[model samples]
Target: MDDLEKAETVLQALKTAEQQPPQAALPILNGLAGLVQGDPDAPLEVQEVRADVFMAICELGKALHRGQPAEALWAPALTAAKRWRGLLG
Candidate 1:
């Protein structure tokens, strides 16, 4: 409901998506982006990590859609998700 609550939800989603398919991370990233919307007071780190997540999701999708192996995206996606979670703390 509030910024902290939204951040926590984003953290949980990021954590869960870390070990799942990158596709599973897309909705979570999108949700977090929407949550961060209008949050002009959000920390700079939060904004940066949200942007990272958005970029990572796009890259992951592109790789997957191009018939590349899902494993190729997993590590980077997990790393970015972890970074996003840490930045929120």
Candidate 2:
């Protein structure tokens, strides 16, 4: 898919992540990362938010593996995801 489509998919995945278990959300985030693959052509704001989203995903994964509560990650993850969605407009 194209970058915009990929971004939309990432947004959807992020939304889904909010409701899903950590086990399920991890793969969803991974899939969104793979879908976009860090589109170099995107604007600086989009790139920044994308980086934040990816970082949040990585942190979420690490937390899950470390037995930390997933709740702690959702706020930042959702914030970044919302920023990303706003950038798309």
lDDT of each: 0.61, 0.75
Clashes of 1: 0
Q: Give the TM-score of candidate 1.
A: 0.56
Q: lDDT tens digits, residues 1-89, model 2?
A: 66667667777777887697777776776676675466798888888888888888788777866768878787897787777767776
Q: What is the per-residue lDDT of model 1 for residues 18-56, given as tens digits with 9 covering 90 to 100?
A: 566656655555565575453557678777766765666
Give the clashing pairs for model 2.
none
Each prediction's TM-score against the native? 0.56, 0.78
Candidate 2 residue spans exceeding 4 A from truth: none
